[model samples]
Target: MGWAEKRTGIAFAIALFAALAAPDAYAANGAYAVDAADISEVGSCKVESWMSVATNTDFSAVANPSCVVNPFTPIELSLNTNRARSDGEWSTTLSPKAKTNFVPTGIGRWGFSAYAGGSFDAATGENLSAFAVIPATYRLSETMRINLNGGWLWDRTVDRHYLTYGIGFDWKFTDTLQWTIEAFGQAGASDTPSVVQPRFQTGVRYRPNEIFSVDVIYGRNITGENANWITLGTTIRFPVEGAQPEHRRTGHL
Candidate 1:
């Protein structure tokens, strides 16, 4: 098999294994921990924003806006901004990413997708970090799904490479409310594993309709800094054709 196929196989295996052996992992599409194995519908655009509050008056916020062009069809292109404040200092970074799904997610079906992105200094334009992730998903039913992720991260600031892994679960409690949880971590590239601990998050999402959704999440070690945080987030979608796709309706933004 090819490289992507191999990773695809491994990711799917991990997803199934996680369902039986463990639990679940997105920040990419629908929820946070692992990304969704689907992209926005063609001719559609979306914006996701979240504010995180940590102890000691530290704060972080992100605004991600993305769209799928007609010719690119299934691929999503996004350019986003991340701003943070810690210890009386503030910093901003810009991230650009591209994502596409090889298989569509559905009830009783397997799905997979690839995401690649990098972050750069908004002021100096210096490269900071880059990553590539493969996300695999299984929808046991319309209301529940399992997601798994495997990838590589280049932490340029630290001059290190790490293998990344994540697992997460998404479940709909009602037509307009859902719950999600995930655990994700990384291991060092060398023989010794990473000294950092895993990060975790769980939250409820409220969607009054197809066009909008909001989230309230609690996170532990969210940035590998051993800090606890509360996040308030929102997602807004607008389809050019003015109709939502079935797949988009089933998955998170």
Candidate 2:
């Protein structure tokens, strides 16, 4: 099998093993928000997948599958793909992301993380430009935390760049339930109108067990096209042998 196929198989196997093992774990990433500083325990693996559909039929449906490998205490690597279908035409984009945690969770009152990644068209196999972001989180209380992301995306296809940012708050209502709300947007590069409109999203997450969690979210664009979308997703984590026990703390999802 090809390398991509092999990787997919391995990820699937790990996910299946995690599902069957049934350990207490937590997932902080949201349906529509990226986790700035959240990482699984060292030597563990996580699988996150979701499907989103637009309220209008003209917009394509998107399916995303992401796998994360945490080999050390402060660094994690991720591989993910976006599969989209519109009017019977399908396209796929693959991306690899790396995150470094400057302050590991529960180690201090505040945490920081930096991430960088790029996406490529599966059909053309051309290298897309890279992007970077710094995400910071502050612990307000045991049950509340706030996160912010600021970054830039350089578009090779159009030879343009854009500023991207997100602000969000996470609230834990119970050990197994949480809610998140965020506003995110992109601004045009160099005074041009932003290609990506801004949007507001809210979601709820429920963890029925330690290793599994579910999310439901809805969002709408604040400017241009008036588009609305909803997403459903689940996350699963597998603890490798010798990995540390789960760390429960408030941080970005």
TM-score of each: 0.83, 0.76
Whole-model Cα lDDT of every candidate shown, in order: 0.64, 0.54
lDDT of 1 by residue, 1-253 (tens): 2322222222212111111111111245433656657455555677778788876567877777777644433566776677877667787877777666677676788888776777787889988777787788889887889888888877777678778888888898887898989888776654323234787889999988767889999987666656787988898877557544533554432
In model 1, the runs with Cα more than 4 Å from the true position are 1-26, 70-73, 189-195, 242-244, 247-253
Candidate 2 Cα RMSD (Å)? 9.2
- The 10-residue segment of model 1 with minimum total lDDT is 16-25
Task: Name the 10 consecutive residues with the lowest summed lDDT in model 2.
Answer: 17-26
Q: State the lDDT at 79 in candidate 2.
A: 55
Error of 1 at 19 (Å): 22
